[model samples]
Target: MKMTDDNKEIIFNNITKWLRDSNFVMSEEKITVVTSEFYAKAYLQSDHEYILEIMSATGIETRFALRIRLPVSEQQLENYENLEPKEKLIFDDKMNAVIFPQRQSINIKEKSAFLEKTISIDPKSIDAKQEVMQNISNLLGSAKKLEISFDELLSN
Candidate 1:
């Protein structure tokens, strides 16, 4: 899934437009272009204070990832993973309460105060990439409502 600089640039622009269409504000400074021999990344932010990161592998890695940050913890993630009656909505202020209902997860990587879910994408085909992006955009749309709710919890 290694991507060329040109391909990365094209994808970045398309994602920018998608974010705008979603009514997210991508300030000039919030859209960062980062590239190295092993990776190319786009770090984006919105007026709502949500951040989205898109990464492409430029080395031996066979996949890219789309991730977003969430305020969550490792113990909380473990509990979510261990859910027996997953259909039940159990929320705690310390968990990713908003995303739990959607069955989405935060891949707890040294979960501190924040964690994220990384969805890998096979970037070998343009269609696959497009589909993945569309899927993420759709998910983002759905998550917006819960994100606001989570924000209120934090404010309390």
Candidate 2:
């Protein structure tokens, strides 16, 4: 549970490599790896049925949202959707990243803006962080006709 500096570096290297392997280029600054809060309900309806509600003591969404300035296809978006229900992500066309554990931001013009130099991790990392957590939630699911709650989606 205690991650030493060396251990952190190792994880960081792994994370960085995975991100690059996923076609995300990295910058020399503002790169971080940290645990993210569960924003699951932030994007889910109270009535929506998901293994997330069934398996974890915390229903809060610890999902990852990567900011990318790249134009993503509906198919690319679907790939993240097919991820485990617990693994949620919202990619921005203004930011680019392969993965980071949580979201990071910067204050700009008196408004909080996503740091241009940051990269957030993907939800699939949960399988590495906690297999039991990944197992409880369905990962190998379908994204065909994905159902999204507009209210939940926009609330984030």
lDDT against the true structure, per candidate, is 0.48, 0.29
Top candidate (lDDT): 1
Model 1 lDDT tens row, 26-60: 54423234542222223334334445655554443
Cα lDDT of model 2 by residue, 25-68, tens digit: 34432323343122111112231232111111111232232221
Off by over 4 Å in 1: 1-3, 27-49, 60-63, 73-105, 111-133, 138-156
C-alpha RMSD (angstroms) for model 1:
7.2
Considering summed lDDT, which 10 consecutive residues are worst modelled in model 2?
Answer: 136-145
Reference-based TM-score of each model: 0.44, 0.28
Positional deviation of residue 32's Cα in model 1 after best superposition, in angstroms: 8.5
